[model samples]
Target chain A: MNWTVRLTVNGEPHTLALDDPRVTLLDLLRERLHLSGTKKGCDRGQCGACTVLVDGRRINSCLTLALSLDGAAITTIEGLAQGDQLHPVQEAFIAHDALQCGFCTPGQIMSAVGLLNEGQAGDDPERVREGMSGNLCRCSAYVGIVEAVLDAQATLAGEKERAA
Target chain B: MNRFDYVKPATVAEAIAAAGAPGAAYLASGTNLLDLMKGNVVRPERLVDITQIKELTRIETLDNGDVRIGALVRNADLAYDASFARDFPAVAEALLSGASAQLRNAATVGGNLLQRTRCAYFYDTASACNKRAPGSGCDARDGENSQHAVLGWSDACIATNPSDFCVPLAAFDAVVEIEGSSSRREVALEALHLLPGSTPEREGVLNPGELIVAVRLPAAARGFARHARYLKVRERNSYAFAVVSAAAGLVIENGSIKQARLALGGVAAKPWRAHDAEALLAGQSAEPEVFEHAADAALREAKPSGDNAYKIPLARQLIVRALAAAAQGTPSRMPALPASPFSAVPGALHDA
Candidate 1:
């Protein structure tokens, strides 16, 4: 069944002609909208490689049907930066050496942003480890990833406080 | 993925009508259902989208203090609600402990209630999984049976119900409000999930078109939640299915256990509530020895497969640990390691 789904990707509005009702949100973003920053690792919920923020909540995009979210706002890894500048999470990832092959980095950053938004990004390493357990790095760069999330969380908090 | 037609139902009647199709399945959160669809485990020709039914998304409390949680309530919403957290902290903890934050955010209460087993053999399409295909034979019975059932398992299938919320709901004696098109009925939460006896394909007794509207937990659980705990032990510290989980609640008065409720997972086809064990706890003081007795009683009927015999002793100690923590009102406690009772069993040497 073909359906037209209107979605707000990043900041711009898009109306995708979904020919297949079985198309996943990840496929819709990557194939239809050409937002390939979101990689597909397991093609299932096991890996966090397809993580994206739908209405400010991190979800496995591969497991979400695109047609189900008709008017939802989706934030992908491509939407994280502003004019060649990286998001605080992306900057923290580069500073802390949180990636090796960089396949899971985008999902990791998106999940980290979502976790911080949910107030789960604590300064404690153990708490961060538990909060970021969903995003797995095959390169075993967890120590650096944990450090980066904590640093990005502090930076995000500072930016919020300064703005306020 | 196979092509499927989808319809967004606006009301409960429309949802029921849409779901009345032989090849129709209701899509609430699409967390597990979509995974299964992509895996080719379940192929539905049509999907009845019930998320548009706004009334099913509410969570409220009755005038009598019973909690009525809508089926469409997302796991994260119920897990993080301040009022629910303050009232039923154990239920909140149970919801939080099941899946990752990303999954919890997308998983609805109805999806969690009807979540499929995570058995390795059942997921592998090439393998013979009776749950997936009737009369296909269960390969997990003799192959890679480390996580298979140790209780309430028949030769047909040994897959356990992979639900953390169900453990506490069984202990709370929650009532499921089934909303049919023309009739409404109530089924106890414990009875909602059936044992996989002969038909592993049939997980629950809900009619095809009937929708689970809400789960109503009695007012007793509100008071009982103060002393309840849901302890889950898994292969990893997080993001793994339970190796053996126990939900326990005890009402102690004057240093003696007046009432007790116990439910176990990862060791049974359904959430195994130990009635005999709870009966033994009444009028007894909450002590390590008493907890051990209850644990022993719970595992007395356990029939473990050769490779997974370790689950027997492992589950017994978990029950003891969970009960001990509940009796003491401890928020967190480590499960005590006991010597494996099945160390002598053949092919179970890894547990020794």
Candidate 2:
């Protein structure tokens, strides 16, 4: 039996009419919606390469069924930047060389964004490393990753202060 | 994955009815269920999504101070709840320490307990796993058994329950609240999981369509709220399943150990509670010698596998060390699991 699901993917509304309920959110994103920014490294959820923010919480998209998240507001890697301007986490990643192979960058960036949104992350490097343990960098680019997160936190805090 | 109809129910009763549908399985969070489905280990014809049963997501402390944790409470939410974390640090630490933050954000308290074992043989359909296909003969029984069970393991299966939360729940002496067709009931958290006796396929004690709505943590468990510590000995420092983890809590007054609660995970098919050891610790001085005696008595029933025999001493040291830390209200650390044989001890060897 098929189900119709309404999802707000990357701030865009999508109503998927499908016949297969086994289509995971990852598949629905890449195959149906063509939002291929969310990488699928390990579909079993062991690898966080398929991470995306569902309702502002980072979750392994591969492990989530599409029908289960009807009307959910999903934020993929593609949704992070604003036109020519990159998200602070994204800018900090490049400034810090956070990626070697760039395969895990999207998920890593999304996870970092989700971490900042949760307010659990501090300017502390060790805390950032622990909080971002879900996103693995097989390339061992952790030093850069930690640096980027800290720098981004400073920039984000400044932006908030300016806004206030 | 098999073709399954998806049903999202608005109420617990409706969810139970959906579960009655042919080969129905309740899906919460889907962190565990989706993985099982992808592996073809469990093929439910219909997934009864119970996340919409809004009432089941509540986390409330009763007037009596007993805590009721709703079944759908996300692990991340529970871990970060200031009130809950302060009330049960061991339980909260265990949750945050178990899975990746992304996974914790999606995994639910109910699914954490009901998730199946991570036995390689069980997941490999080509391999013989009695738990997956009963009477198939367990391939992990004699092969790659290092991470297998060291206690309460049968010849049919040598698998360990991998939940970090269960150990602390056992220490808390929590009660599992369930809803059935006619009425509601509660089962002690220690009894919530059954040892893989002769029938390894029969994992939990829940009847068909039975729903775990919430878990009630007794107010008495607050004794450990300040002194409790959960120490997991795993392959890596973080985000790995335990090989042997101990949840220890001690209440001391006037230089005597008044009460002790201890439980071990990743060493058995179920969370092994050290009740006898805890009972013996009452009124005894919290000394290294007395703690060693308690640790030994706790592991007396341990029947180790061929390669996992190292877990016995590892678990013993962990219990003693955890108890000491709990007595002092500090964190305890141990070497990683899968260590070289005779590693928990330095410069000491031979059969005891």
Candidate 3:
């Protein structure tokens, strides 16, 4: 049986007819929608390589069934960068040299954005490290990742203050 | 993952009816269910998606002062709720201590209560697991069983419940509300999970189509808010299951204990409430000696199931440490790392 689901990805709405209910959101994004910014690693929800923002909350997309989500807003790594400009987190990742293999970069960036939005970690480096413990980097780029997240948080905070 | 029939039920009655068929399972966020399906550990012929049921997403305090948490409420939501966290700090700490932030945001409270054991043998489909296959031989009994249960184990199977949230809930005497096809009933959260007897397959007390609608915390549970803590010892600093975890709550007046509640996790098939220990602690002056005796009483019946004799002593020490921390009083805010031993009050390492 086909299940129809409506989702707003990065701001663009798409109504998809899922042929199989077993298709996860990660697969739907990479395969059907052709938006492959989200990577699937250890798809059993252990690894956070498939992290994405669902309705403004970071969640593992691989464990979430596409059919279970209807009228939900999804934000993937591909959605973070504008036409020529990158999101603050993406820019900070490059500035801090947070990527060695660039495999887990998108997921790390998305998770950092979501963490900043949650506003729990603040400027505490230990809290940032604990908050980002879910996403693993096989290349051991954790030091750079932690630096990148903190920098991005400061940038976002400064932007909000100036706007206010 | 298997391609099963997807049925989105709009109401509790409809969800029950859809799940009444054999080989049918209820799907909330599909955090654990989808993982099991992908691993071929569980193969349901149909999945009744209950996420769209708006009623089950609420977290409200009833007029009687009882906090009713909807089954579908996300773990992160409950932990971050200001009032709920203020009332049940230990529970919030325990919730944050479990799985990563991403998983906690997606996983529901009901799903956490029903998650399967993390035994490697149980996850490996090639191995024989009595809990997975009813008549299958138990491979975890003698094969790499360092993480097996230390208490409440029969000859049939040996496994421990892995939920950190259930530890504090068990201590606070949480109640689980169930919705069956024909009627609704309630059961204590402690009794919801069954020990591995001859039938290790029956993990929970729910019938085939019965659904966990909500979890209710009694008003009296709030009394422990001032002096409550959940401490977990894990292999990693974070994002890991507890080797031996404990939740301790105390009510002190005039520098004497008025009431006490204690529960241990990663030690038994269910959240083991230390009733004897609580009884021993009542009316006693808060001291190191008193906490040690309570720990002994709590672990009096604990015995190693396999190669996990180390768990017994570890649990005993954790119980004592948790009680001592509770007596010291809960922190004004949650520790940065939730329940980790590393997250304990700074400069207090001398206590350990």
Candidate 4:
């Protein structure tokens, strides 16, 4: 069943011709849209490797059918940055050395962004660990992942203060 | 995922019509359904995505003080709602305790309640899973029975219900409001999930055309005994499936038991409400001995599988601890050490 889905991706409007009902938003983004930054790990929604923002809320793109999201806005890891500059979360990941194999880095960043946007970034390590538990890093680099999220919170707060 | 026809139904009537059709399934969040389809556990010819129905997305308070949670309410939203936290702390805790932040964000309340078992055999096509293929055989009965059901399990299947939210909801006497092709009716949350008796294939009582519009919790807020807790013991502290879990809600009035509601999970085919234990607590004084007796009553009927015998003791201990903690307004003991090699390190960060 082919359907025409008009939605905004990373602030740009797009009209895609989606033919397969089984093809998910993750597939559309990676295969059709050529946005390969969002990696697919488990594809069963167990792994958070395909996490993305749907209307600014974190969701497993692998679990979301492309036809279901007709007019929904999507933000993938490829859309996280403006021009050459990285998002605060991306910068924090680099600063804290949060990645090893880097396969799950995009998902981690996307989930972190969603968490931070929800104003759930807390100072407690346990709280951060629980908040970021959705995105799995097979490299087992969680200590750095926690540190990166915590660092991102500080950076984002500092930026907010500067703007204020 | 196999190719399938998808229809986005914007109204409850449309959804019900589609669901009534042959080989059609309602798509709430796609957290469980899509996963099963991709794994070849369930191959429906048509998927009716009901998330677009605006009526099923609202969460409101009824005049009777009962909370009405739309089927489309995301687990994350329900977990974080201030009203849900205050009125139904158990529900909030259960939602938070299940899955990871990302999964919760995508998983709807209805989808969580309807999620299939996490048994490896059910997921693997090569293995025999009666739930996936009726009368095929349950490989988990002999293969990896550690996480299989210890209660309400038949010879045909022993896969445990993987939902964390339904346990607390069942304990609180939640009601499921369903809209069917012919009529609409409300089914108690406990009755919403069926036990795996002779017909292990039938998971719920909802008809083929029924669409769960909302989940309504009964207005019995005062009965929350001094101790009410949901204890989830799992392989990992976070992001792992529970090996055995218990939800205890007791009402202690003047140091005497007014009412008690106990439900067990991970060790049962359904969110098992301990009616015998609740009956034992009736008119009894709140004490360690009473809690012990109640736990014993609950475990008396338990028939554990070979590898899942540990769950019997674990469930009993959890019930006692949950009651003790709730009595004192705090959980007394930590979760038991995970038997699996992937045990979560205490106070350490592990990705879900």
DockQ of every candidate structure:
0.54, 0.53, 0.73, 0.63
DockQ order of candidates, best first? 3, 4, 1, 2
| Segments in model 3 whose C-alpha atoms lie over 4 Å from true places | B344-352
TM-score of each: 0.94, 0.95, 0.98, 0.94
lDDT by residue for model 3 over B1-352, one digit each (tens)? 7768889999998999999999999999988888888989999999999999999999999999999999999999999999999999999999988989899999999999999888887788999999999888899987988888888888888988999999999999999999998999999999999999899889999999899999999999999999999999998878999889999999999989999999999988899999999999999999989999999999888888889999988888888889988989888877778887765463232124
**True lDDT of residue B96, candidate 1:** 71
Interface RMSD of every predicted model, in angstroms: 5.5, 5.3, 1.8, 3.7
lDDT of 3 at B22: 97
Candidate that scores best on lDDT? 3
Task: Write one digit per residue (lDDT tens) for candidate 2, span A73-150.
Answer: 999989999999999999999999999998889999999998898887667554577678888889989999989989
Q: Which 10 successive residues of model 3 chain B have the least lDDT summed? A: B343-352
**Range of the 10 consecutive residues with the lowest summed lDDT in candidate 1 chain B:** B334-343
TM-score of chain A of each: 0.96, 0.98, 0.98, 0.96
On the 0 to 100 scale, the lDDT of residue B349 in model 1 is: 28
Per candidate, the number of residue pairs that clash is 0, 0, 0, 3
- Residue A22, model 3: lDDT of 85
Q: Rank the candidates by TM-score, best first.
A: 3, 2, 1, 4
Give the distance in Å from residue A69's predicted Cα in candidate 3 to where it truly belongs.
Answer: 0.8
lDDT of 1 by residue, B1-352 (tens): 6778899989998899888888898999898898888888888999999988899999999999898999999998997887886666667767877777789999999888889998878888999998999999999987888888898788899888888888888887889999787899999988998788899889888988889999888988777665777778887766777888988888898889989999987887788888999999999999999999999998999977758988998888889988877887734321111111121221122233
